[model samples]
Target: MNKKGMAASLLTAVMLVSAGCGGSDTAGTGDKGGADSGSASGPKKVVFWHAMGGANTKVVDQLVADYNASQDKIKVEAVFQGSYDDLLSKLKASMGTKEGPSVVQMYEIGSRFMIDSKMVTPMQNFIDADKYDLTQLEPNITGYYTFNDKLFSMPFNTSNPVLYYNKDLFKAAGLDPEKPPATYEEFQKAAEAISKTGKATGGNFAIYGWFMEQFFANQGAEYINNGNGRKELATQSLVNSEAGVQTLTWWKNMVDSKAMNNLGRKTDDSKKAFSAGQVGMILDSTAALKGLVDSSKGKFEVGTGFLPKPANAKDGGVVVGGASLWIMNDRADDEQKATWDFIKFLTSPKEQAYWHINTGYFPITKKAYDEQSVKDNMKNFPQFQTAVDQLHQTKLNTATQGAVMGVFPEARQIVEGAIEEVLNNKKSPKDALDAAAKDISSKIEKYNKTVK
Candidate 1:
């Protein structure tokens, strides 16, 4: 055979060998690279992993299609992981290898976890390099992914817990649908009245409000030393603080008085109760907007409203609640570039505005709020606007950054168990929270050592 023919045969053998190895899976990441070392024509394929489900999932997939159609430079693929835990585990295991997708949607609390693994690219680097207007972003939401003044990730969806009421119940119970509870006292009274009436049961909500942290935030209390979660120093425990104790005590009282139920968090059963008119008021997540709206089955008009705070918490409002997005660093250079592009596209004003209107998540871009479509919807849909308005009311000091302890999930579970003890009369509020404080402090120390 000629020399050229021999080279062709040798190349085919190399291709077969590469395919059986794990190299072929790397391209499966959907990142693009061309024949030349300097290929920049755009990625031919990109893989995106997320845990979004149901009708909302469709919107995300459509958005991917829209991005793909906008240019021939990129082709995107979407894969749905069952839950956040599943996605986190999968991503971690695939790190340093090519089995992972180029882009993944991660939650706000997971931001640090992702960063600690050193598998994530600080998204702010990409933003700066591209000269994107970082200031064009809302300052409040940006804090979620910030660490030591550097932004490590892009926030995707932010969900805060709000008050959702049964409009007909509100009216029938002699309460004005327009005038919802503005303070914890008002909330208690109103919940009590609604419970006694046929509108709702007195104990609709339980020991813990939806989200669990609102009582502290609404009361203008600093949950910890730094809400931003910079805990390199020996962080003090705020749950033992005056505001923390006050909130937990009040919650205990609320449950004991039967104004709110001592039941568990929002579950499928809880949603059913609230939807079926068994519960008059619920402090639930904004993401549940789609769920509640759909489950109502047109039986009643679902009225959404801002969360009520304590009278003492008057003047300023609370910061946002819920999740955000982060990008993983364990991928090829081409994949990181592709993921960054997708992140920008997803957070663009048009997408933000649409997502805000459709889902319960808040938009991180001020421009999204400026859109005529968003404005029109706000006038038509007060729920979306209420959250935006509250976002500006957020406090910006270290106290406002929110929590970042590794055992946070474990800490939250401790809080849950303690709250349950209080409701069941198994322990006093002081004892319950005190026990949680001790447990959390210990866990925080252990996690700190690991990081240290």
Candidate 2:
């Protein structure tokens, strides 16, 4: 069963569910231009559910308001649906019913599940229908959402992991403040140097599964077989591979050396430790660049660097990390089209610029880089350039494109547990990863069978 090859037929299944089981297309407007003229009561409504929180939520609300103000045919009502996991669970519960949102935002790992569920329209259809120019968008970002040569969702908030270091601490440790570590060996030495300063610990990486995946990609290692699941459904997890074991071994060594602290699994906790000057460096998403800079404004100068790789690694790149917009197919044609229009407005160069500056996410549209605001932002926060450079430098390979599995979220949890076990000295890196890989492979096998 080739998953990507099933898209066209599954697209029809999605539409049938929308028109037959869900609702009829009452609005006559077929094109993307405008919706039907509503009665004197009000405009047609398009419901949108998302998982953006904190400062990002405000930005989302403002964007939604801007879109509504820009048009009168359709009124887009935005609803915050908690975290990404929560939003996905809610969408699952709302499937086949009118209660689901016309548009929803889902995390990157949910791509396989979304495609398999057949509950949403392929963004490719809208692109083909409207002659949308996808070339205008960032290819690295779009590559993640593209499956079976078709884009299933609109790449919205995109990001990658980077190393954040405290320059003040670096200088205090008699290290060059301008040069951040680029390899695991260099990272260990720098961590030891920073710790020797007695002012802050060397570094701390949250026991995060995403970081594990990134490290595997950093070494040009596939996280799963079958071209990281892009070529076909993945039946196994390669978390026990040499790259995976090397990553865990390096991480466990750092913790054992007391150069880096094991701060549990919460990225926020690790971020706070860095902000409070308790840790000199940390690994975090590019989307946190803005908040981290603000938190360390008066305390220390923050510097960014590419995610560390093994010293021997010759080829690898960071995978795109973030969420994308999905259009629920179980909605009226007018509402779905309206959702498309809103997505277009959001992804436009201008909006992407605003989003990039405000949220610290990569502007999915390339033209956004030409925006004056973006140029000024680049100048003000030069550390952001590291992420942009890393993204651009990435090669379009399966490892960099990232792995796709319906059980990705669960797999991440399993990997995190393995990390915890190794860091706690309860299990060897190979032993722990072997167990985690076995568990994830079992889940993958189950998922593939169920989907088939």
Candidate 3:
């Protein structure tokens, strides 16, 4: 849902979905870069290229305006490249070239790939080099953006998946809106009841269900393993695990039982069924809140809540999702200084609050959460609180830390396709998952061997 995971790099919907949350990405308060950080004797100017659109990107423009007005020491120029691929291609082409921006916005799944490239400087170095105060920030939020023992990027547009429900459907189905679904049994019952209404083809619980690995992930299962070769890598696919099978099975059964509809699904689906009120409930990226709200056009009431629990649920916490800001190097001294200053400014509590209010993404800084401005805005609109509440509910792990692999997007494709076969009655859930595990293992092994 959030444009930060494997989907962010591979799926177009998730990336543009972020654009709906806030203003378009644009130039910052500092000057555009022609030189590097500085000459070790003068101010620096830097250019930052990102893939933000609409209002979400515009926030960057205003911030840049303010930064430029505030100081003469550094100047930053922010540019909105096309999509994730566009930015990546631009970055790839800029490598070793003089015409390159000093900062870039990267989606999460793209992180490890970039880290492997070794063309950019880690933000930990940036923070240490400047002595920025990262301690005041929420460690968990930043953890989602970190890799290895060092940080290559600072957090921005962070969010987790959430269950968005249609209250009217719940009421029509004779279910309590306040009690959507908290347990596995209850969720099934709700779907069954909604299906009984014959609103459409059975009852459809909308989302990128096949692609969203939240259930097993939330339960703390391994999507990848410690492998340096094919055997270990193949053994670690984890799709055959009890939790993994259970997760995939539940969805297949839901579709077979006519409690959920499997319709028009592909590699990338907009889930127009849910937003158009053709379905009852959906678990989507919190970053899509604004778009969902805008798309609804006030026809039906939107209810937001945490994902439901499992049958013998031993855990109830969720995981983090979304993207981060990466620093691109090769700038002169003045540009580096400007990029550094602007980077620090972007994470400030004030700006964080603005980003949260203007966009539904979570603020990375603790101060942003407690700031009166943020609290007041959330007070006026409580649904925003639901996302924040889920923050404490999630305890991070590999499943939730997200599948950091070279071919995760492909692995996801394998799994998602396997599930679709089951739902489409082309195969049984058990058989589908087994086959998916095999296909995924093959790719995982290929990727694992390539990794250092």
Best by lDDT: 2
> How do the residues 71-107 of candidate 2 rate in per-residue lDDT, one tens digit apiece?
8887887777666665655665565445677888888
- Model 3 scores what on Cα lDDT? 0.65
The candidate with the higher lDDT, 2 or 3, is: 2
Model 1: weakest 10-residue lDDT segment is 15-24
Tens-digit per-residue lDDT, 181-225, candidate 1: 877677778777877685566435543422455666666565555
TM-scores, all models, native as reference: 0.83, 0.90, 0.83
In candidate 3, where is summed lDDT lowest over 10 consecutive residues? Answer: 13-22
Which pairs clash inside model 2? none
Better of 1 and 2 by lDDT: 2
Model 1 steric clash pairs: 30-45, 119-329, 120-329, 156-325, 203-261, 205-261, 206-261, 227-401, 227-402, 228-401
**Whole-model lDDT values for every prediction:** 0.64, 0.83, 0.65
Candidate 1: give its CA RMSD in angstroms. Answer: 10.0
Ranking by lDDT: 2, 3, 1
